[model samples]
Target: MNALAAELRGILQGPVLVGELLGRHTTWRIGGPAELFVAPRSEQELLAVLHLLAQVGMPWMALGTGSNLLVRDGGYRGAIIHMGALQTMEFRDDGTARVGGGLPVMRLVRQAVRRGLAGIEDLAGIPATVGGAVVMNAGAGEQAMAGVLQGAFLAGAEGMEYWPAARLDLRYRASAVPADRIVAAAILRFSFADAEMLESSVQHRLSARRKAQGVGKPNAGSVFKNPPGQQAWRLIDESGMRGRSVGGAQVSEKHANFIVNRGGARAADVLSLIGEIQETVRGRTGIMLEPEVQVIGEA
Candidate 1:
């Protein structure tokens, strides 16, 4: 271990795991070990860890639920800060919530439903952290975080500060939030709604997702962003790439846009399959599909 690793292990308020396999953390169930993995219990601890990382000039990456991520087989050389321990969830007297970025988005959805709040009912099915959702503007159809997110708390070299949602430039499964900073928390504004109506909407979305997606398999949700006026699944299906397989990775037959691990898929297999789909779709439709899934680390 290096001097920096030695110091961090001694000072951090949480576990500093060495050679931690990322496959155990991601939804895809694939990836090699990270050089160091830290799960800070409080915002102060998180900042301290980041400060130490900056002092040593060691690269670091923020980890959410790893829903839409692909970490390569060679693993990441930098430190990974898992935000699961930053699980604060506070509801206000007004119809808004102050949530820890690490809270599972669906858990937030359930809380909102219980509170008879609207805005994120349609997002009940997405497997993402609130922080990840904000970064990607995760949504389905016409509903998205942009509609409810009021502001975010960001921490980086400049220290922690709040930025309103309008300033974040969120749009279409993407956000302008800098990749280097960590989202510590967010404020979401919601409206009062009939409890029955909210529950109905949540269930409907969840059911629709289960029916349309590959449910029993381990996979990130969608592999490609839908092009304007065209769904990615439709394009992939039209290109005759449905059910395509590369090693253990397979483009889901149930939903052509999702790539699933049939049991033991490697990150390389998933990447190769994504490439094949992109090539075939572009060749057929003259439109390129952008990947919604974030790929990281090495091959």
Candidate 2:
């Protein structure tokens, strides 16, 4: 790992770290450490780092805001590519917005709302980077990343290329973009609207999300996707899983779909709680819950 880190530092402009604690990067704040971590300075530097990792056949994953992810306690053995510096945002004359993958979704929504853009105002409060949001098709049920996304610049072993929104094959909370192909940048189309109305809509959704999802605790958003003809939270609530805990991890009292870290929660605790909820809900209602949050790393 040291040899690889040294080689990475020599080839890229990013700062490389050994055994960087991943808990600091994720919103849930419960991960272990990454074997190697790099926040590349620019897209070029990111590509260079990827090329080297590929040449040496090392596993790596690009990290965004880490809003919807969980890493196990044993930590990851491969590299973590954090895209924090690619935060440029631009608005064109034709009511379009160009954004970097690392730009925060909150900021993106604010910028669009300020410009009287109506499409992404519904995504106002998601705590995710634009890249991560795009990769997962993040949004509330009424609107999604696919609604505003014209296309994105996807980086792969073949190098970065522009792909249309149709090619993404977006569905409920998921996309076809593979793990290795990072979302570097994207061009999104929006519409002009009354700034006051847009702001009102954004504020309404933000307040609703906070009230429904709860505050004063650390959580990784929704833990499971809503299944066909059913809501996961409703099933969990009906199955008596709300406020249930496995150690420091508990199903949120406010929202049954969320698992929050009460304090000093480990990945094992959350995993155990998730299993219990799935089993209980299935046994009680015959609905097997599917987790929406991405879990990575070794146990």
Candidate 3:
């Protein structure tokens, strides 16, 4: 252990897990371990811990609900700051809702619907956090975080600040949220819609997703971004890579884009399968598939 690790062990007001298994945290349920894992309950505690980490120049990554992430089998050499406990939600009189980074995306969606807030009903079945959703610009159809975000609070080595949605450079499945920074909270502007209409929309979207994506398995959502004028799943299905397996990981028979862990899949297994699919698809169709799932940890 380094000096910084030693110091963090003494200072943080949270559980200090050494060699914590990351597979248990991720939606894919496949990863080795993180050298350290810390969960801070409040923004102040989070900032204080980060300040100490900065002082020591120790590396760290922020983790949300682990929806769109794949950690390597070799594991992360540094620390992981888990935002699971920072879940706080508040609605303002101006028809805006303030949500913490750790709040589940589904929870937020349901709350917004209950309050008759429109714009995020399309996000009904997404299994991530507000921070992760915003960072990745996770969306479907024509709606994304960019469309509803009013502003966000970011925390990083340089410190914290609030920035408007325009500053985020929200593009397709990407955001200007700096790699080193963690999204602490967000202010979302939503229009008041009829409760019945919002509920109907949410249910319809969820039904579509359930039928199309079947998102209950131990798998990262979509493995690759859709190529121009072409859906990735359609391409993969056409390439004849469905039901393919590498180790315990297999391309979901129900959805070509999803790589499911049949039982005890490893990170390397999933990655190898992903590489195989990408290579095969590119070779056949001449269109390179870009992975939407975020691969993290030491190579």
Candidate 4:
């Protein structure tokens, strides 16, 4: 493992940080250090890093913008691949667009809107990269990646490959992409619309979100998935869990489903708060809360 780590450092063209604190990368800003971190810039560099890690059978994980993730206090033992520099987007003469996985979701939305594309306007306030959005099928049922994604380019043990959207089997907040595969880029299809219409749609969604969501603090978006026929926030609020705190982690008063970091919170604190919400809500409503946020690393 040590030998592989050394060799990895020698070959990468992008920045590599050893013992990089994960708190700096995540939205909640509350994780421990990662043993090794690499941000590869191009397809060649990304493939190189993946190949080297695979050769050693070293465990690794990809991090996008870290919008809906949590890293524990004990930290990740393997490589932390940050796909930030793979920011490429090409709009075709046809209605299809090619987007790099690392490009922010809103950035693509804005560009597409300017080009008179309309499909992604509802995804305006979703804070995630294209890759992350596709992997998790990010966005609401009214407008989501599954609605427009044609296919995705991914890198895995078999090297680079394209998986059509049908093969992905995207579900609510999930995709069946092979665990070994990491999304590299995506092919998206959108409808033509007037630029003014797209702009108005984007602004409307953003305004609605701003009114309904908590702001001015660090949060990992919605902490729990809404149960069948029940909104997670409503359930949490009914259970009187809003504004509840565990250490520095608290359920946002404005949005019960959001867990915010009230500064200097630990991963343990967030986990504890989540557990408490689950227990309380379950006891009150007979429905166990399922987390929307992906918790990784060790406790």
Provide backbone clash counts, one per model: 0, 0, 0, 0
Which pairs of residues collide in model 2?
none
Question: Per-model C-alpha lDDT, please?
Answer: 0.90, 0.90, 0.88, 0.90
Q: How do the residues 233-264 of candidate 2 rate in per-residue lDDT, one tens digit apiece?
A: 99999999999999989999988998999999
lDDT of 1 by residue, 73-102 (tens): 999999999999887999987998999989
Q: Supply the global lDDT for candidate 4.
A: 0.90
User: In candidate 3, which residue ranges exceed 4 Å CA deviation?
Assistant: 2-6
Clashing pairs in 1: none
How good is model 4 by TM-score?
0.97
Model 1 deviation from native, Cα RMSD in Å: 1.1
Off by over 4 Å in 4: 1-5
lDDT of 3 by residue, 25-103 (tens): 9999988889888888788878887888787777899999888999999888788999998889999878898899999
